[model samples]
Target: MYIATYIIDIAALIYLMGLLYSNAALNTSRKKPFLIAIILTIVIILSEAGTVLTNNGSLNLRGINIVCNVLGFILTPMIPIAITLIFSRMILTTHKLLLISTFINIVATALSPIFGFIFYVDANNQYIRGDYFFVFIIVYIINLLILVIITLEVGKTNNYPIIGKLVGLSIFTIIGTSIQIVYPFTYSSWHCVTLSLLLYFF
Candidate 1:
C-alpha cells in the first residue's frame, strides 16, 4: 500500500543526489538558506520514512517511531521558515515573527510525546493525531503563504524575470501538500518539496 510512498522517497533521494553533484556553488548568503532548506528537507524525508515504516509494522522500534513522529511534526514547518530566510532583504520583524511561530511548534511537538497534544504513537505502533493537530496544519499553511509572499516581494524588488517560475514553484508546492493533507495515506508532499528545491536551485 505504501509502494507509492516508497517510490516517491526514492525519487527525492535521486533529486538530492543530482543537486549534490551539479557543481552549484552555494556561496551566496541567499544560497546558504537554500542549502539549509535542502538539509531540512532531507531530515523531514527520513522522519517521514521512519514513521511510514513503523506505522506499517515493518519496524517495531517504538522509541524510534516516537522520535520519528516528533521530528516530522516539529521540523516540517521549519522548511518554509528556512525558505523565508532565502530572502535576506525581508523585513527583520517578519523574520522574528516566523521564528517565533516555529519555536512554538517545536515546543509543542517536543512535549507531545507525553502530552499527546499534537500526535502520539499507540501500543500497536500506529501513529495517531492529537487534538491539536490543527495547530500543525495552520502553522504549515501560514509559513507556505509567507514563502509565496516573500518570493513575490523579493522578485519584484529585484525585478526578477523569473517571477512566474517562482509562482509556479509555489503553486506546485501548495497543490502537492494539499493533496497529502486531504489524503493522509498519500506521500507526495516531500517529493513536491524536493522538486521545488531542485527548481529553486536552478
Candidate 2:
C-alpha cells in the first residue's frame, strides 16, 4: 500500500532533480529553498515509512522506530519553513518568529523518549501518541500558516503571480494533512506534499 505512494515520491524526486539540473533559473539563490524543501520532503517520506515498518518489526527495532518518528516530527514542519524562505525577500534573520514552532517541536520530540511528551513506542512495539501529540500537529499548522502568510505577502508586494497557485496548493496540503491527522493510517499528507512540490516547479 504505502510502497506505491513512496515509489511515486521517489519518481517525483528524480524528476524534480532532472528539472532542476536542466533549468538554470531554478538553481538561483531565490529558488534554491524549494530544492531544499524537496530534499526535506524526501527525508520526511523516508522517515515516515521507516516508522511504519519498524512499528511492527521487532522489540530490538524500537530504537530505530523512535529515531524515525522523531525525525519525521521534527522535519515535517520544516518543509513549510523552507517554502517560506523561498518566498522571502528579506534577510534570514527576519524569519525568527517563523521558525519558533519548528524549534519547539524539535525540543519536544527529542525529549519524548524520556519524557514521552510527544510520542512513544509501547512494550508491545506499538507506536503510541504521548500527552503532547497535539504539539506536533500545532507546530505543523503554525509553520503552514506562516508559509501561507509569507507567500501571500510576497505575491502582493512584488505583484508576483504566485498567490493563486500557492493558495490552492496550501488548501490542498491542508486538506491532505488534516485527513492524516484524523486518520493516522491513511498516509496521504506526504504524498500531497510531494505533488505540491512538483506542481510548484511547473
Candidate 3:
C-alpha cells in the first residue's frame, strides 16, 4: 500500500506540474497560486521520498531521516495552505502572512530534533508524536475553515463556480489531517492533498 500510494503521489505531482507548465489559459486570477502549488508539490514529493528511502536502522542514516522528517513536517501543512490560497481570494500581497506561518513551523521543526516539540524520529526511524502534534492539525483545520469561508463568501455573487469542489478539498484535507493525527503511521495527509489537487483540476 505504501509503495502504491508513493507511486500515485509522485505521478500526480508530475502530471500536475506538466498541466500547469503550459497552462497559459489558466484563469489569470488563480494562475499564480496554481503555479506556486506546483512548486510546493515538488518540494513535498522530494521530502516525502527522502523520508521513505533513508529510514534504515543505522545511526548514520538517522541524520537523513531526521532532516527529511523535519522537511516533511514543514512542507506537509503548506500544501493545504497553498491549495486554499489558490482557491480563495488570496494573492501575492497576502503571501507575507503565509511566509510568517511557514516560518513558525520551520522554527518548530528546526527545534524538534533538540526539543521534540514539533516532531521527532525515534531510534527506529519511526515518527514519534511530539508535544505539538495537534498544532499541525489546528493550523490545517484553520486554513481549511478559512478556505471554506472564502468559498462561501465568493459564492454570494453566485459566480463562484468552484465552491463545491473547494469545499471537497477542505473536507478531504480535514479528514486526512485528522486520520494522520490519530494514526501517524498512515501517511494520509500528503495522499489526501494529492487527491484533492486531482479533484481540483479534473
Clashing pairs in 1: none
Best by TM-score: 2
- Please give me the total number of clashing residue pairs in predicted model 2: 0
CA displacement after TM-score superposition, residue 30 of candidate 2 (Å): 3.1
Ranking by lDDT: 2, 1, 3
| Poorest stretch of ten by lDDT in candidate 3 | 90-99
Q: Give the candidates in order of TM-score, highest first.
A: 2, 1, 3
Q: Which is superior by lDDT, 2 or 3? A: 2
Clashing pairs in 3: none
RMSD of each: 2.7, 1.5, 2.7
How many residue pairs clash (N, CA or C atoms closer than 3 angstroms) in each of the candidate models, in the order given?
0, 0, 0
Which tens-of-lDDT digit does each residue in 145-182 have in candidate 1? Answer: 88888888888999999989988888888889889878
What lDDT, from 0 to 1, does candidate 3 have? 0.71
- Would you estimate the TM-scores of all the predictions? 0.86, 0.94, 0.83
TM-score of 2: 0.94
TM-score of 1: 0.86
Please name the candidate that would achieve the greatest lDDT relative to the true structure. Answer: 2
- Evaluated at residue 187, the lDDT of candidate 1 is 82
